[model samples]
Target: MTKIGKKATLLAASALCLTGTNAVAEDAQTQAELDALRARVEALETNRAGPANGDFRIGNTTLDVYGYVKADFFYDFEFDQGDTAFVNVIGEPSAATDGTFGATIRQSRIGLRTSTPSGIGEIGGQLELDLFASNGTAELRLRHANITIGDRWLIGQYWTNFQPLDTYPTSVEFNGPVGIAFARVPQVRYTANLGSNTVFSTSIEENVSGSNSDDPVLTAAAEYNNGTYIARASALYGNAQTIDGATEVDQWGVTLSGSIRPWAGGLFQVNYIHGQALGPYLIGLGDAIVGGEANDVDGYTVEFRQDLSDKWNVGIAYGREDYDLATSTGTLAFTELETIHVNAFYKATDNLTLSAEYIYGERNDVNSGQDFDGNRIQVAAQLNF
Candidate 1:
């Protein structure tokens, strides 16, 4: 209990406390180094699996290669005209399979894209092609050769950035369009990103009219998109020629589209397009109005899809188009045509899928009126790298 004894005890206690604090500090430094080492290893592993480089680079140079090859076997039943035309065009065994079955490549495509940073902005190019023909001849499908001066300018032949993704429903047999897309053209586009989730874009491409060397088709669009929902409005205008010997200029229309996911993996989508087909702009029209050939096409589509899981998927879609024909005596209006399709898919594996689809269509034109009730059950195997 002496004063000297108390001072000695306090000094010993202070030295022990200092030693403990130094040990804790050393442990903290070691933990920080471990964390940094783990992060670096993860970055290297990710880069090894993906592109040689990571998602981005300091100079803003990036590249991606993506594509899939698919083949399927299908059999059509309920021999009808509406459906027969679609199947026969794709080299199907006519309305009657004739007890013979065959397989075809369903749009096996490959694409490459790369972008490099420029002083002003970024310049990029993309090329997509299909190589399924018997001779192994590849055909160019998507080609976007252009520069994006900031986010405001893009000159290329890529998507117009118009219609919503839902416009292209899930079809096992990918013949594409099937008279669904009123206008899908090539053009020079200007896109402005208002925010992270909002964008406005417009394009001008070669028109059917306005002289053999006139400006391209004109299109403008605005869209707001989040992870779950996308809403868009777009317009298309161009010169079109008439069915007869006359030519009228300046034909255009507007479109609205949106998509929503209601459940874990379910989606509902709809698109409305109303436009005029004047002069040359109606070149893509498929309605035969007898005496009325130059007619405006207007239509809409509704599509829905549900993915039960990675193995199962189902979808349904309906589309209708009305053509207002230009007749000699007067205007002849007809229902034109309508189509409904349902499809289901079962994934046999990550590289294989089995699909079945049913499509029904009706046309007001007698020749087109042949009830097209077609059913296709196909098994397809795909490889992706």
Candidate 2:
């Protein structure tokens, strides 16, 4: 073996090593270029498919459409004015004594929601509609049209601030317990989150109908919610006006509502309201001011709901409204109204439900000293998407 032989062997080995390193670098560069090309193709495909899928994106905003289809069949043991009972108006002296059966899809609803990124925060808006029309025909009616700016301010028509939405019981009826504060009106609302479990909100809303006044209804509410227990308190102040613009009455109301989960899948809710001239704020049972005098009213609702299993649940509720018209010179159509509801719901699938309810109501006329009782059975099927 000679020095020249060793040197030649070392040079040949180094040349082979350099050639292998260059080949490896070339292969890595080729793979990087392929990945870049694949990503560009995917971007192009996504841009082309967005519009065809009905989910077109605008800037940084996304829009979604959602709703449910619901059908209700009902039978009444006593004749009422319509398919659904007018519990407050059932005890008139001219009431009929015939049973009725009917069906309605007025509770079916549709909605659109949008979210957009802004410099201040995320801006969100929702428009919702249902088939509950004003003229007894099933026409689309606006249920909610509102915009939420950032996380604190909301403007447009939404649930009234005095209403305790969390306290509402599950029911098969389109309208839940009658004594619960329920109303949707145009409002300017502000919400503040106090830590993780509490919230405070206030709003000014439209109060009376055709009242030629500048003052609006004022409301404030506070709520505390942990995973299992919830509590809420709200207050309302508004004005009542007459049709002829002849008289106006000042009205105020306070509501205390709460719900407790005693055990897994069991909930108990109670709502109590006492007010002068609360008729307009309630479920439109009567006028807040009759004959230029404000009516003092008290209403309460108690509901117990139990979930027997993942797919089955039952609820029982009782509600009452009492009017103090003993000293009023006006003719009172109803002085006391009571209602009971027992309902069960079964989830056929993740997006479909079947429910049945038995509803019984009694109304008393203070002026006529007459009482009328009505009973109804309702069955409903709903599909949500």
Candidate 3:
């Protein structure tokens, strides 16, 4: 290609990267338009990070509306876990039908984000909601409602600071594979950038598990990212008390997680967490305390993803959790949990994706004396904007 042609291609890529948008290719585009777009991209690139790049602008603030319309269809081969693949519920067979089919649009969500420049730096806010509030019904549930100041301070509800949010496994199921820390809570957090690729942060977060306690959770995290690889370490501690003020214990956890790009279109993600009185962070829905003592819990997840082509990709993930109960007064105490997902995705367009996945899960009860398993297959279509 000629020098002019090569420059045009680079100009287009810069435009897309700056705006975070996918633009349709045009056959009759002129050189003058490309030159103008390149100028805009260059200006934005020269500015500091976290600049508002949304298509809509009101005064100094830029607004972006995002989210996806997702529909999922699944069939349980052994036991039903509802629209969500909550495999931990698998239990001894009963009159409940084994082979059941279900579908839902509850995973669909919408969010609005806005950012404006300030003398201190930049101010931003986000409000996000989804339709998964009620079981078996689509009700709007709040996902994120937060404000950020100067890209360093965050206040309000968001993903818990301790979760490895970036390294979560990719799956067609809304719930994904479990055995990982996952929670959303209100908090005030401050972050310090060590350089272009490293950051340290701390927060005092609301203790959702401490209904009877008067203190907030303290969390700290450090992360390093250089485009091709990522690593993070996080720790949290707080006082938790059981309802009726029967028992109060120290609730704490530590997490190590990372993602690596091993080859072109190939990625690997792994995470490990160990804690006591984990609360809702453990998606297994287990109690933070059992029999007047904090439960010791450990969980991990690993996944690999490979791209077959520009339009197709596949991923496989395994997750597990083990519990050490200080006291077990019944035979139904859960001792272990495991789950797996094998999934494939095809992008029909820049904004639409179709996917299919197979899910398998197991739970061990009463000191691993009894085991239950569940199998299911799922397919989904998602349209993002």
Please identify model 3 stretches exceeding 4 Å from their true place.
Answer: 1-52, 92-96, 209-214, 326-331
Candidate 3 lDDT score relative to the true structure: 0.83
RMSD of each candidate relative to the true structure: 16.7, 16.4, 9.3
* Per-residue lDDT value at 296 in model 1: 63
Candidate closer to the true structure by lDDT (higher is better), 1 or 3: 3
lDDT of 3 at 337: 82
Pairs of residues clashing in candidate 2: none
TM-score versus the correct structure, for each prediction: 0.68, 0.83, 0.83
Model 1 residue runs over 4 Å out of place are: 1-62, 78-102, 131-150, 175-184, 208-215, 242-246, 278-284, 287-294, 326-335, 347-354, 366-375
Please tell me which predicted candidate would have the highest lDDT against the true structure.
3
Task: State the C-alpha lDDT per candidate.
Answer: 0.56, 0.78, 0.83
Q: Compared with the true structure, what per-residue lDDT tens digits does model 3 show for residues 227-313?
A: 789999999999778887878899899999999999999999899999988845776766777788888888989999999999999
Worst 10 residues of 3 by lDDT: 43-52
Model 2 TM-score on a 0 to 1 scale: 0.83
What lDDT score is found at residue 311 in candidate 2? Answer: 99
Superposed Cα deviation of residue 153, candidate 3 (Å) = 0.7
The sequence of per-residue lDDT tens digits that candidate 1 reaches over residues 1-385 is: 3332333345455544655566666877655655565565444343332235323332456655667777766554443232122422222124444333546663678776667778877666666666534343444444344445566776655555544553455676553223344233456788888898998888886553322324456778888889698788888765554346355445666778888898899999887767665322221244323242334666677889999888999998877666666221112223444666788888887766677766655444333333333444445566653
Quote model 3's TM-score: 0.83
Q: Note the clash tally of each candidate.
A: 10, 0, 0
Residue pairs of candidate 3 with colliding backbone atoms: none
